[model samples]
Structures are given as C-alpha cells and as structure tokens.
Target: MIDDIMSSIFESGIRGRYSFETFVLNLLKEHIAKQDKPFSTNEKNQKLGDGYAEFGFDRFTGPTIVDIKGKASKLTLISAAFGLSARLERACADIENLSNYIIVFGSRVSLEQRKLFDIQLAAKKVSVNKNVNVILWGLDDLDKLATKHKKKTKEIVDNIFSLRLEDAINKSTTDWISERDDLLLKLKSLYKDGQFSLFLGAGVSSSANMPNWEDLLNSLYVKYINNEFSDEGLIDESKISILADWLSSVNDTSTLMVARYLRKALLNGSSEDALFTDQITESLYSNIGDKANDGSPLLTSIVAMCLPKRRGAKVKSIVTYNFDDLLERQLEKSKIDYKCIFSEGVINSPDELPVYHVHGFLPKEKDSFDSIDRSTLVFSEEGYHYIYTNAYHWTNLVQLNSLRDSSCLMIGLSMTDPNLRRLLDISARSTETIKHYAFLRRLTANRILDKNHEEGRVVIEEEVISGLLKRHHTLSEELMKDLGVKVVWYEDHKDLPGILDSIVD
Candidate 1:
C-alpha cells in the first residue's frame, strides 16, 4: 500500500495523491489539535507547529505520541528521527517526563538498524535523563495509512498531475503570490507616505565585490602580520592562513576576536588612527575598484527609490551596517544629493538625504571629502561592547530612532545579529505596530515558480513544497512580528529585483 503511494508521489502522472496528502494532513491535525478549543491549522505558529510536514501539540493536554514511520532507508529514518526529535521538543519540553516514545516501521527492522536508530535517538541522552519507550509498527501493523483513505484517488491524482509544473507551483498550498502582492502594496503605501527608511547590511556591499567583515579581518590580519614580520621576511598568504586557523580553531565564531586583535595591533593601535583608516579603506576598495560604481539591478532599483519624486514622499534617511562606501559611491554617481553622517555633532543638511554609517565610514576619500571619522568604525570586540554597553552612544540613538519612528525596509541583512535584535525588540515593545519590513529567503519551503522565467527546469513536488512553505511563511512572519518587522520572503535571490521593482516610486 505504501509502495503504491510512493510511486504515485514520485513517478505516477496523477493528482490522486492529493487524497493521500489530505489524509495525512488531516490525521496529524486531528492528533495534535487541542481538545477543548478549536485548533487552527495555521502552519506558521512556531510554538504549536513545526516547519511543514510536522505538528507540535502542547504537552499540557496532548497525548504521549508514538511516531510511526513507513519503510525507509537508514539515512531516511535517521533524518526523520532528527526532524521528529525537534518537533517533539517543541511539543514536550520535558523529555524526562516523556513516558512512551515508539517508532513503528511499515517494514522489518534489523537488530543493527534498530541499534542505529536507538543511538540516533540516544543523541537526546545529553538532555534526556529517563529511558524512553520504543515500539515497532511493523508491516502487519502499518498498512492502513498508505492503502487509500478516500475514494476517487485515480481521478484526483490524474487532475493534479495533469497540470504543468509551473501551473502547479503557482497554485501550490502556500499561496505566496497573494502574500507578495499584499506586501508590495503595503510597501508602496509606506513609500508614498514618506514613512519608509532603508536599513542596509553587509549583503549590500558584497554585491559590489567587497569582502565581508570576516574576510576583511582575515585580509587585514594577513597584511598586518606580514608588515610586522618584514625584518624576519614576510610570510605567504598560505602561512598566514595556517596561523589564523590555529588561532580560530577553538571558536568558530572568532571574527570578533580577529577584529579585536587587528584593532589593537594594526597601524599600531589607536595611536595611529589615520594610518589604520587608510589601511582599511585601501583593503576595501583595492580589488573592487570602480566595480561598485556600476551598481547591480537590485542596487539600482534601491537607488531609484531614493530619488526624489515630483510630488510624493521620497527616501529621507539610509542606515547601513557596512563600513564601505559602495552605497555612497552609487549615490554620488547617480547625482543624488546625500550626506554621510558618522559622528556625534554632525547631521544632514535640510532637504538632503542622510546616510547614517552606524558601523563607521571608510570612503575612498575623494577630493570633495578629505576628512572622515576613523575612530567611529565598529569592527572589534571593544567597539561592539562600547556601543552595546553605552545606551547613550550616538550610533545607538540613530539606530533606535530609525526603528522607533519609521517603517524601515531592511535589505541584505541576516537578521541574526543580537545587537540588531535587541534594538528591534525595544522598538517593537515601544510601539503598538511598527510595520517594519525585511527581506529573507525561505529555508525549506519557499519556492519561486515563474512561468515566464527562461532558466531552470520547472519545479515539481508542489504538494510537499507548498506545505513546507506555508509553515515557513507563518513562522517567519510571527518571528519578525515580535521584532517589530514584517517579513518579505523570496525563494530565490534573483526574484528580489522583480519584487522590489513592484514597489511604487
């Protein structure tokens, strides 16, 4: 029975498989829903749900679950167990209180394979203190699930599978198209209302071929070491890399550590601030010279939005986490009037755009602008500590004001920075509804199926992917909501320009 279902899913050109999906979704929904109140199938509820194919029930009233699996390879089983473990954790926080946990296979399980799965589950041993119950839903035990729960399977399967992949994807369960349309309208409204502020992160600079902070630190470290070793003879890049590996082996997230060392040693610490700034500025633009001036379509579109309209509201402020001057260079090329504000006493002139460099500024130091604030660069551990610990810091006030006052459109940001998250939290808590926006790609579920797209094969597996996307979208929206922002999701980065273009000028 399960064999036929799998065949229908992957090989058969039939939509009757929809029945199986409906059946499975229904079963899981029924099993996990609250008993007293109506349980919504909102795939996005993080506390009550997993990404897509899984559901997490509240332990207070939910039953002890015995997750049953169909016949699968060891790898597949292991993968499912890991997923189930996460889902179970979301449902029941206390594993020691978990009385029974079973794995029922639709096929036979060898002792070795059984041991393997036990070991896999034993991974929880670090947090789990009590023995877990395990039961097998063997071949004779698990036939009911896959055989067919509803009639008209053949007809439904034929109809669903008949549609071309593109058509199927557009009509997938997640319905991101409608959601995207809604987001665009909201963005346009914000832009027209003059409430939109732009927040840029490292991703924006990389598009122009600038090295990320970590890579910049790596390069700077290599150069600084070579200079220091000039008397003994300079070491090659490979040797510098080896030394770096030795230093960062213990902590994978040692970018800050590297930055701290460089801030202390490079250009002889803060005593030679001018030289340090020059070194960093040279490193940033040496390889990517004039490349950023060309500007990407995404960047161009962003710049267009910044241009003043004949009547409507225009971009008033821009805040970037990058230390490079790529955005400013583009603004200059486009002939848009903008000012770079990086210090305490400075502010943009009236009727001119303000580009706030909360991290610091290291422009190419063109003839027009000879002086810059090198001391404001926030790259090292000490710099971050200073800003985070000092609430009254000028940069903090600037960032806090951006979130607290306007509807910020964040691009090229990972949204993982704790400092940014803290600011967002404060902004969200302070306001009733901030309606800030950020662009993020989907992990497992977000899929873009463009009928007019000239590249790549048509996407299949609409049923599964859509389910996954629905969960992803919901959770992302909810998560960002807590941070006072709305999530604008794209399955592929290429779709970003088109989506951004949809925003009205």
Candidate 2:
C-alpha cells in the first residue's frame, strides 16, 4: 500500500520540498526520542547550510550535512548533483567535525543516473575519510524506515498523501472556464476601456440557418443548373467550388456572379431577384421594435450584450469576413445606430458604430442587382489575389488598422481562410505589438462503439478516430502559434453569448 501511494506521488511530480523537509525532521526527532538520545534541529543559516545532523558522541558519528530535494528534470538533476558536491567539500573543510553527508529526494533516481552522480562527485576530487560516508535517501528507503517504526509515523504519511491525492483529482476534473478567470478579467478591462473591437466570422451566423462555404456553393450550383442535376449522379459535391470556377471560365464571366446568386437565394429570390430592399427594411424595423425573448437569435443576443445601454454612447467598430448583413440588421434592430462601410469612407458622426464589411455586402439599391459591381465581392481566386496584392485596398486597410490599434476578439473564426490568415500574418510581422484573442470550440474525443459490430472492429475504429483527433490538435497549435493569437476554448456555441456577457461585465 505504501509503495503504491509513493508511486502515484512520484508520477504526479513533487512540487516543493519545504513540507517534505519538515516532515522528515519531525520523524527524525521522534526516532531519536525513542532511542533516548538528544536531537536538536539546527537553525537555518545560509552561511552554514539547510541543517546539520548531530549525535551526542563525537566518536560514534560526527554531525552530518543534510539536504532535501524534490523530483527534478534531467538538467536540474545534474545541476543539483554538482551543487551538493561543492557544498559537501566546503562544509567538510570549514566545520569542526562533519562525518557524513545525507541527501533525501522525494522520488527515486534511476540506477544509471545514480552512477552518473557518483562519477561526477569522484571527478570533483573530493577527499573521503574512513569515518565519513555519503547517504542518499530516496522515497523507497524513506518509506521502509517510516514503516519499520510504523506506530509513530503512519498517521503523518497517510494524512499528507490523502490531501495531495484529493488535490490532484480535483484539478484534473475542473472545467477550463473556471481555470481561465484571469483571461476573462483582461477581456473585461479591454472592453470597459473601449479599446476593443469584434471580428466576426461565418460561425456567428451558423445558428441563424446561414449556409456554410461549401453548402452555399452547392446551393448556387443547384440553382444554376435549374435543379436538373441528379443528386444521385456522379457529381462530386466536394468539388463544387472547382466546378464553379470552370463555369466562370466557360461563360466568360466572373465568379462574382456565383456569389450574387447565393445572396439572392438567401433573400428567398429567384434569378430575376433584382433587389432585397423590402426584406432589408422589414428586418431592420422588426428587430428594433421586437422585445428581447429567450435569446432566440444568437447574433442579436451577442450584439445586445455588447452594446452600451446608455443612449449616445460611442460603440466600438466591428469587422467581419462574412458578406451577410446579419450583424448590421441586429445593430439596427437594437436601435444602436451604426455606419456600414463597404469601401473607403470616414465616419462623420462619432455616435454611430462602424461596421466594416471586408468581404462586401449584398446590394441594398434596386439597380444594384441589375448591374452588380464584381470588384466589391471577394469570392473568386482572382478577387482574393487582387485584394492581397493591393496593400491600399479598403478592406485590407481596415483589417490592418484594426489589428494595429485595438485588441480584437475574433468570434466564430476558424483561422483557415487564406486571405484572413495572410492579412493577420502581415499585421503580426509589421507591428508585433498587440495580442489578439479568439474563442474556439475545444476538440473532444468520441468513442465509437457499434453495438452490432464485432468487438475487435469497434476497438480498431476507436483507435483510428483518436489518432486523427491528436493530429488535428497538434496542427491547430502550430497554426495558432504562427498567427500569434491566443485562443480560449469552450465546449459549445451556445455558451458564446454567456462568454460575451462575462467579458462585458
């Protein structure tokens, strides 16, 4: 039982030596008392050492030099070995009668490492007299001694061991939300000072039935083919983007047409959809007039939590990669006035919040649908190349300026978009001043066990999934490092509103 307890403690790593040293001293005192010999703990004096071991008779064994150590890494162990060797030599030469040196470690040392220490000490050319000896007491040796005198020390060992075990278990099970209180505090500080902005991505709109990149492209393809393509045919859905690219080349048209189709479809319109002026106006009015419910709209709830309650307060700017007007609609509904800037323009009014649509927005005017501006939307390969090459582009300028000036909180962002990643990298390299933050969903393991399958097959499938998750986690860490962004992970998207609320509070 004692060996099992000691092994567990060793695996967990010893933290500090003060408590262990005090316990050892108390045990030594009790042992001396049982033998009817006087024992006194030497006062701590840096000039002398940690403590000294003294027996009443000088002839039996002179005062021993004592040192206590916690478990350490390989480099630390080497340093500890050399340091102890030097201390031993100095003490023996200065003290009156030091006969032995005793060192106690919280964990055992491997045989190879022990031999290395001995060799290092021998190389130091320290003289060893006939009466003096060096003693190393590891956990195993200490346990044996404590158990041999079981009646006196058993309670002390059990009490300390149990407390440490409970602490370890509690730490392992605690939620990350509780552990990251400091990060929350920092966010709140930034928000309160009005030096923070929000950079939103498609993830923020996913809850409102927004289509993802692939899904949006697939929808456009279906619409373009007039629903003639059979879903069961050899059409590979994964390659839909490539197909769109091919369509653009064949028709001698830009891929921006595809984006236009997608936006029109989202507004519940057909190819002849000229404008969404009516829908935009209705959405704007309804959101402003409607009372807050059980937070049915995720984006609106987040905006409400962030917006200042007092009238005429200046709101922080919001930058988004999404082309949809969801955030703008939410702001309008809350009666929080904002400027939607898709191109270069100054906000003449300081009271209204600025929403920079970096990727472009759907046309609000009737004629915009009839003659769409291909340069505004950044969806095609050529569009992305042009935007990135032109440093003075309005979208690039807004994103770079935001990164340089304020600490941004990126929400619903994957850090996977090439354009977004390139812009961040340029800012990080040029300025390297501000630290940005993001909220991501923590990756978790899934145990795959098909009840109808053979047991062996189930085990194999589980292992494969576990391996993939591990690799994904490693790659994610590398990407974050390159981007120089710190991420706070949550379990679910539903928790996002609460997280935003906590930051504001």
User: On residues 1-505, what C-alpha lDDT tens digit does candidate 1 reach at each position?
Assistant: 6456445543211122222333333433443442332333333332333112222243323234444444545874686556655655554563334444445443556777767766876674423324433444454333453333334333334543332232223333556668778888989988888877999988778776788776777678666766777458666556877775665554456677767777678757458666776788888887777676786777877888888888743686899998877788778888888888887877677777999989888777644454565338787787788888888888889998988778899999999887888888777655434478999877553334553234676675767666666655665565666577778877766777778777853
How well does each candidate superpose onto the true structure, as a TM-score? Answer: 0.60, 0.51
Alpha-carbon lDDT, every model: 0.64, 0.60
Best by TM-score: 1
Superposed Cα deviation of residue 459, candidate 2 (Å):
4.4
Where in model 1 is the C-alpha error above 4 Å? 1-173, 234-251, 267-270, 445-474
Whole-model lDDT, model 1: 0.64
Q: How much does candidate 1 score in TM-score?
A: 0.60
Clashing pairs in 1: 14-157, 15-156, 15-157, 15-158, 16-156, 16-157, 104-137
What digit string (tens of lDDT, one per residue) describes model 2 on residues 389-449? 8888888988888877887888889877777777777666543223678888876554344
